[model samples]
Target: MHGTVFPPIEPSEVISTFFFIVLLFGSFMTVVIANRFIPAVINVSFVKGYSVICLFIAIWEMISFSELVNPVLLPPASRVASMLVFLWSIGFLQSQIYATLYKLAYAFSLALASGVTLGVMISYYSNVFSFIESFATAARVIPAPAWLALSILWFGIGSASAIFIIWLGCFFPIFLNTVAGVAKVEPVQVETIKTFGGDKWDVLLDVVLPTAYHHILTGSRIGLGIGWITVVTAELASPDAGGGLGWMIMDSRVLLDITSVLCGVSAIGFLGVVTDSLLNSLEELVQTWG
Candidate 1:
């Protein structure tokens, strides 16, 4: 029997490959321009590091497609690039992105509101703190995935379940950090406020809250990260409810389409970086105001 032979690459495949190369080149050039002309406005080191990582990955993908590595198990970067383009063209990727972000926003907002409020109450009243601290500690120790079964049972396989998972993942960090920050507010500051004829409400609003803002921001950063992870996990577990990046990943895995899986992973990582940077900027502004 003749050995199996692959067909020659088509013109469209060549064009797609060229487009991918151009895309990478453009990204590299953008980084170079930013570093050289806008050094003070950007994180030059981070941009450089990211460019190097992308270059390394592109080279590795080229090597893989040359048959040095098993492309069947780890699809080449060109394949991933084509898959991303296809997803974007179909509008499915955008919808999934929106769904995930919408759930994250809702869950994180709920976490912020409840966490801060309860945290302040706990910090102010010894009785409330005593009643809740042990429970909060226990909840914090449990992994987010541990609650998935119960969340699914209660909320079913949909946005409600995903949001609940994200909320649980985000809540404890914010709560704990706020409690710590409020507790650390100097007694002298509170006394000074009281001496100025301020009541408990005024003291809380004028002193404790402002002092704890930094810590609360830190908690929010941590919670956002956790929420991102939890939402993806929940979507992966319940892909049929609301198609998301995680659902795309699971579907790709089932088909052994490693390229699509990688694309999904990249999308998640990119979103995380963007969101974290925005939060960091907001934190800086808050710090300046404080």
Candidate 2:
């Protein structure tokens, strides 16, 4: 039963696997060392939290690979690590990463710009907001996946389709949040600007925008996550059009390469962490400046 469930690993591969494990441990140690020198509360907390998650994942993988569970369905962490190296060595990994990142950047930028602009306009005009509110509410109920077919028909399978899906999924949250934030801006502030001989433009720029900045940032964070999910789903739906992490996961599943699938999942998860952290840092910087 053990032989059938857990195939033998080559000695060289085992040695290399141990080396990889040691490298991970060393990296964790390096983070701990850096944490000691870092004075910022947020930075230290983030490092510690990240380290704990990594450690938990490592332990989980170790236990899963110990023959306590079926290895066929859940390959060892070492196998996934090796698959990652192989993908990188063959130049597929970086290209796919670039493709996904490019689409994400483009779609997220469009959503942010359009959402914020339209939201501000809608908030300023009661008639416009009244006209659009029902449609926006209905659209929010429809899943992003539901638009893939129409997007494919309109954009004809490629980045265009994926971007449209991403933008569609991300836009609502940002737009709604922006409207809420603008509406919540203290009326007294606007009145004060008016009393100072400021025009509507000045009230918007000086009072409304700054007050709503935090809300906009919050919406952006939420929209970014939704955009990432939408892009991956879009890529999976149209794998032939573009190579991305999602495509890699789908291809691995087709080939029955569970290790490769796991690697792709890990890559996506890691990238999400990095992107979220960067955005959080940006939020902190903005808060300080404001």
Worst 10 residues of 1 by lDDT: 4-13
- Model 1, 139-256: lDDT tens digits are 7989787888888899887788888889999998999999999988999999999998999999988899999999999999999999998889888887754778898889878876
lDDT of model number 2: 0.83
The 10-residue segment of model 2 with minimum total lDDT is: 6-15
Tens-digit per-residue lDDT, 36-78, candidate 2: 8875643777777868877875775676657677776887676
Error of 2 at 23 (Å): 2.8
TM-score of each: 0.89, 0.87
- Report the C-alpha displacement of residue 288, candidate 1, in angstroms: 0.9
RMSD of 1: 3.5
CA lDDT of each prediction against the hidden true structure: 0.83, 0.83
Cα lDDT, model 2, residue 227: 86
